[model samples]
Target: MNLQQLYYFKTIAQLEHYTKAAEQLNVSQSRLSHAIGDLEKELQVTLFVHQGRNVKLTRCGAFLLEYVSQSLDILDRGLEKLSDFVNPDTGSIGLSYLGSLANFVTFCISRFFEKTGKVQVHFQFNQTVTQTIEDSLMEGHTDLAFTTPFDNKNIESVKIGSHKTILIVSRDHPLAAQDSVDLTTLANETFVTYSPQCMIRNHIDEIFQTVGIQPKISFEALYDSIVLGVVSANLGVALVAEAVDLTGCHVKALQIENEIPEREIHMAWVKDRYMTPAVKCFRDFIMESGMLLDQYKKK
Candidate 1:
């Protein structure tokens, strides 16, 4: 009828003696008998019958025993799993980041594991654009995110580091010859840029507005690598974050002489959502090791 009644029935069914079961459960015999009597009345079935000086299960009791044992076992296992899920050193964290910050995330995670020895914390990583990352956080799909700063009342963010936005041109382009170029000098040049969905695109647009130049956008891509690939063909020059891997891309990352805002990286999470211990641990580590994480920036 209830958990306590089921437990008493299980113990009595196992030992087959009312006195022994009471001793094992540390309950008085009268209390155990009353609980069993109430359970039988509730179920309208006798669960035990007297056999000599001991007791044995009735036909219905044996059938009920099988189901009760299984249900209790499942409940016990569920409790254990919940305990492990809340453990700071052994739980899992769902982390999301921009594609460009993949290396930085790797560096931070490696250092985090090193500092917390014997940790069994699992990390699930998602690489996406800034808008999707923010959406993921808001929707509870991710526990933490590395992305560009945005205005969201329900999300909290802290600046981790920033990447210098630079101009990239093909090897044969005229601007590639210059060590540094002013923003005004490229006002007329056709530009390859990030899509409007990408947060960095907004920053790029702001810079264009501040410099009083309307960029003629010829191509738009979602990722920095794709934008670089487009620039490699000498199609158009692009302004992008400086920390991209340009190993096979034949584009020159030139310094911009004009003063512009750096593309800042931030660690963000839902303001009021419940965070597991592992997620909070990693979030605190990133907040404290901001400068250390900056050392692994792509050159």
Candidate 2:
């Protein structure tokens, strides 16, 4: 039977009186009876039997009632979830970003939550490399990314801010004593850098290439923190974004005498994917806050 008939059946089964059920449902008793009669005729089973002025479900009716109750409950929950999904005040967002942007993302999220008091937006964070972030967006596994600009045509990006490249060397390293050093002088020094798959690695490679020298790479790590850790042990020197936290690492940051392009950070998403209200809320917040650049300036 149709959903309406099933609903009527459930209501009648619960109340156990046709007149009362019809009144609660805002329908005529005869209309309710005819609907149930049609349903029983379709199912070829007597659903109810008179108990004086009241009605009691038949054996078959009781079994059907159990299934109908479960099905209706499931449908009601589904409807509720759908409403929440579209509502800006509540929903979930799949957010991905580079490990280097962890602090910035945290600040943005905290501020966003503060601004939207009583909001219930949940974030699923994926800290990954630029390539994987792009793939996730394309595959619909991720809704937004704080990363380097994607080269894919299917991905759209907005430049959020830039990070000045800096050099990190061990505390005891000779260059650590210098206020600034030229890249040409470090041509023969061992370098600790991100893996080739990482977007920051590509930027580092470009800088080295621009200086007309190939750095002697001694170590490759996935994240900036790992690279800094390697440099702290005097394993090798590293070029990394200035935003990278130098808190616990015993590495000295140095300014580059040589001109280098700042590492650009972007907020990227799939070009043609449906954005949930939560996703839009976050994306818009970041875009409007100017917090990215403000944080960089504070640094």
Candidate 3:
């Protein structure tokens, strides 16, 4: 029920063994067991199941573990924020972005540091950048996020600009020589695609559904890099953000007509977050660097 109990439960779930968790917590195994038992009794849900020495989180335990993890992250960020207040300019700016926006992200970071010379920036990449942005903003896990737009009502987002969607294929593919190809043309072809949960994947699916076309899917990758690699290996073709360069493996772009609309990438933060100085500087830099504008104008 309390932070300590939640923390104890989380530690046990993570270690997967009461004895090891006790050793790590610097407490007796009996005490750790009692705490977990008390937590389960109060919450009226079994948190873990044990077979001899090995312990695994039960369904309820897995659910609670998520809550505990988020709570810990909030606490850690809160502490970091407090520490940052002691020295504003040198404070860390936690950033997360989609892999497809690597170039834009790199350019933005470079420009921000070069221009500001006062703010320290820390960046991380997430395959699901939109969800990462939403979660980070909602849970205070990050200071800012560069992500694609999503219909999450819990955050404030500024649409910087959009990035083009291009069809990529291996050199040996028959359609690789085409100037552009219709989505309908690939209806029966095995397609290599990113995970269905990705924003671009959803957009691609919508386009296919609208046109009454279904490409036979060969693979689904979690990362844009992997999808491009798969396509270049002649596994299948995919529509992806143009940030990927298919130079290595007999690759070519098959432009889709009526061009699938560019995905809108944005800078997002929690709606009511008290903006830290470092975070504000990073945000200002992104808006000023024209990275978004440049991406919008790409051929």
Candidate 4:
């Protein structure tokens, strides 16, 4: 009926004597008998036969023994698995990140875990604001998120690094001849970009308005990869995060005659949430590894 009662019955059946089973189980003989009695009453079945100076299992007890043994095996395995998960030196750590940015951060995460050899990291692609993704982390849906310039007032975060937003043009473009291009020069040029809600898009729009440039949007895409594909076709120039791959494309940086804006990438967690030992180790590793700093230094 219950695990303890089942265990008592199993030991009693094995020894064929209540006194011996109780001594082996570290329980009083009366307590063991009472527990087995309660179990039989709950199950509405006789589990043992009493004869002159001898004991034997009932027919029902023989059948139940097989199942109880298997159940114990399963329970033992379950406990072992839970113990592994709770181990400080070996556990799983969950992480969420924006799609394109993973390419820049994956190496760092992989190397950190490899060196420690104590944590299993689970990574997810979650491209959302700090405010937006905080709920997921708080609700135990994710452990940490690698996000961009976010409203971090409500979340605990560390500025891991920043990515430069570059205006990329094809080699054949007229502006490619110049070492630098101005926002005003792009006013008449067709632009391929992400939706305005995207952090980079908002900054690009702000820069356009600040510089008095009114660029025409020829294509709007959700992903940087799509934007790059469109730009490779020479359909239009695009402003993208440096994490994007421009390989195989005749792409050239459109160095703005004025200053270009950059976006900060941050690793954020729920404020005051207790990080598991594995997660804490990873967090510390990321801070001391200098991988993000190295990435920011790249042109």
Off by over 4 Å in 3: 1-88, 119-129, 247-249, 288-299
lDDT of 3 by residue, 1-299 (tens): 77888878888888899999989989998988888889889989998999788899999889878978998989989988777653546666667777766666677766566777764544545445455557766787777777776687877778888767778888888887798987777777778887766667787787678667877987997777788788878988888876765556568887778545567778877777777766777777676655564553562
> How would you encode candidate 2's per-residue C-alpha lDDT over 1-299 as one tens digit per residue?
79999999999999999999999999999999999999999999999999999999999999999999999999999999988877778888888999878888887788788887625887789998888998899889999999999888999988888888899899989988987889999988999999889989889999998888988997998887788778999989999888788998899999999988888889998887888888888888888876375575586
Models sorted by lDDT, best on top: 2, 1, 3, 4
User: What TM-score does candidate 3 get on C-alpha atoms?
Assistant: 0.65
Scored by lDDT, the top model is 2
Query: How much is the lDDT of residue 297 in candidate 3?
Result: 51
lDDT of each: 0.88, 0.88, 0.75, 0.74
| Residue 213 displacement in candidate 4 (angstroms) | 1.6
Per-residue lDDT of candidate 1, residues 1-299 (tens digit) = 78999899999999999999999999999999999999999999999999999999999999999999999889889989888877898888899988877877888888899987626888899998988998899989999998888799899999888888888899989888888889997778999999999998999999998788999999999987789888999999998877777778898988888888877788899998898888888888878876544677643
Instruction: Give the residue spans of candidate 1 off by over 4 A.
Output: 7-31, 50-56, 170-180, 232-235, 248-250, 290-293
What lDDT does candidate 1 reach at residue 145? Answer: 91
Candidate 4 ranges beyond 4 A from true positions: 9-30, 50-59, 62-74, 114-135, 152-154, 176-179, 248-250, 288-291, 294-299
Better of 2 and 3 by TM-score: 2
Collision count of model 1: 0
- Each candidate: how many clashes? 0, 0, 1, 0
What is candidate 2's TM-score against the reference?
Answer: 0.90
> If both were scored by lDDT, which would come out higher, candidate 1 or candidate 2?
2
Task: Quickly count the clashes in candidate 2.
Answer: 0
lDDT of 4 by residue, 43-141 (tens): 999999987655689999999998898898799899897775556676566776765576666676667768887545444456554444566776877
